[model samples]
Target: MKKILYAIIPILAFSIIFLNMFFGHLVFESETQEVINKYSVYVHLLSEWQSESKNIIFDVTNTWYKSDKIRNTNHVFDAESKEYNSNQLHEINGKSYVELKHEFSDCQEEWQPMLYRKAVDTVRHEIEYVQGQQLSTDPSVSVYPDTENENYDNSEQQSKIKNGFVQFFPICTSKDTTSYNFSVKTDNKDLGFDVYFVSSSDQRENFVNSKFDYYTESGCYGQNKQSYSGTCHDIKKDSGLLVIFPDDLKPWTTKVTVNLYENN
Candidate 1:
């Protein structure tokens, strides 16, 4: 009986190991196929949207390094996505502008401006300045209006808002990563400070009403920190992060650094 038990134990161990390997392989394949299917759907919708806007969302300077290096990224699942998501900053006519689109990649190349935060810019009173008008030289300061401020009204800088043709492109962050570094620099100082626009009923009415697919949000139009909730065509259901910043960047000949990290 002892001899039989010993032989049976070895056989059971081998069988268990074999089953795990087989099932694990199937699970991986299943997940991959699911992503591929979702990718197909995204390509269809985004491709159509991309056509409407013309192939060029915004012309940004592209940079290529000889050696592709990875750091603080071993655990990041969507490393490739982060790599493609990096922005291209360039100086044209002394104005700094980063193209507003996802960098071209095997997934898809398109631009849909997602980040929105209230910003303060000094316009020579003639050009038009909103009520919240004030000049600040600090990038670290928090200028975003508090949602709970009952006195909050976009009227501070009310004027004829410039409407640009934009669509829905989500700034996706992976579950494996911690946070994001959505910033750019010229001459090593943060864009004279970063300005942003957020999706408030009053702020992103243009975005929601634009040619974007139907957006269902949990928050009202003017609600602070809300997103137009939904997925592209068939991509996996996931959350989006908008890296909003100022558009009025003063251009300089500085070597800019655009990086994405697991945390800010």
Candidate 2:
């Protein structure tokens, strides 16, 4: 009987261990699924723009790879006010993310801008849209309406406060010419920046196919447009980099010159 009792103890302990392992796995799988679902839209965007130049900008702007602490912090739903936490959504990947905290003031408090320079640089590469454009105006501009419309009423103001951050995220990072310029090369009338073939007209059809085929091969996402001349043009290449903001984070354009240096 004593031998039987000893055997039963071991069996009970083994059963408990097995149950814990099974339940642990189930919990882990559930959380992973939640996190993945929350990022479904972003993942789709990433997959679509992975190869385009806009992808480079957006990827740099909204980076997911970061320190565990920042990534682990709950940036989604806000339980306190029973609403979404828009502040946490601004962490655009590790490449271009902003950190904003409310400032204290004796009379009236305000939200100061904490511009992330790295994020600005990420957008710089895509500023190749217009070449030789000067930033005559302030890079970041924000404008607000003087009075609210009757239709909006008080609810509109409250709604704006809650959903305001969503508007700011895109505004703060979109088309930012703070430290750089963005312009297309309009100076070159006849010959503009365009994709061409490495082969003659006879093989041009294959060349066109080859270009698009290469984009797909390189894991680029999006549709390729075929020009009247039968050449494929990547339209979505840098569209994502051309985001516009309302009044806040004002728009600015800069000019760049690629000129030859004359040595004395």
Candidate 3:
């Protein structure tokens, strides 16, 4: 009877050890799979973020290029002649300036004359001073405004008010990256501008109406800037509007570059 009991006790011990080993293996496999699933989700999200960022950059840059081309081809002022070439002043948006002036004359708005005179004078003066010397015939010579000067005249700046030199752009921020960067530069050093990033169209409209009075407590903005570079991280949404407003009534072209990083 004692020998039989000893054999049974050993068999029971062995069985218990075997069961523990099998259960341990199952637990290990489950934990490993969980880790792999998490990793795969991260990789997928990263890929999507990269694709979206590339598309946003391409769209913004393309739009900027088209705008520059249109402005260059359509608007050319001869300061010396003090005239807009009538041939080049073809109907824009299906309405000619000649037609608009005739309509304004008929309406007899009290502000029409002053407004027209200011517009014409501003165009003439800006073109003369901003262009500097006559454009060269050489292909290498650029006709764009020069931005090398680091100093601006305070008197001239004070005399000018912010104008309608505004541009709107769409910006996309990636949740995976959590932030993005931008750089803005103008060819006219005298033409300082403001940059605002807003999460909604309503915010953009508010900014336009308030102009310099508008303020953002949780967004990115650069005010009275000729050239600026910065990063935005407090993004409340995945997409937003980038609004640019010139500080003065000057016709200038600006170049903007946006960047996104995987590790940011």
Question: Which number leads on lDDT?
Answer: 3
What CA RMSD would candidate 1 show? 19.4
Model 3, runs deviating above 4 Å: 1-162, 174-177, 211-219, 238-241, 247-264
**What's the lDDT for candidate 3?**
0.34
lDDT (C-alpha, whole model) for all candidates: 0.26, 0.22, 0.34
Q: What is the C-alpha RMSD of each candidate to the true structure, in Å?
A: 19.4, 24.4, 28.4
2 or 3: which has the higher TM-score?
A: 3
Model 2: lDDT of residue 55: 13
- lDDT string for model 2 (21-98, tens) is 444223233221111100001111122212122211111112111112123232333234322212332322122223
Which candidate order results from sorting by lDDT in descending order? 3, 1, 2
Work out the TM-score per prediction.
0.23, 0.16, 0.34
Cα lDDT for residue 209, candidate 2:
33
TM-score of 3: 0.34
Tens digits of per-residue lDDT for model 3 on 32-93?
11111000000011221212211111112111111111112222333433221122222211
Q: RMSD to the native, candidate 2?
A: 24.4
Local lDDT at 6 for model 2? 100
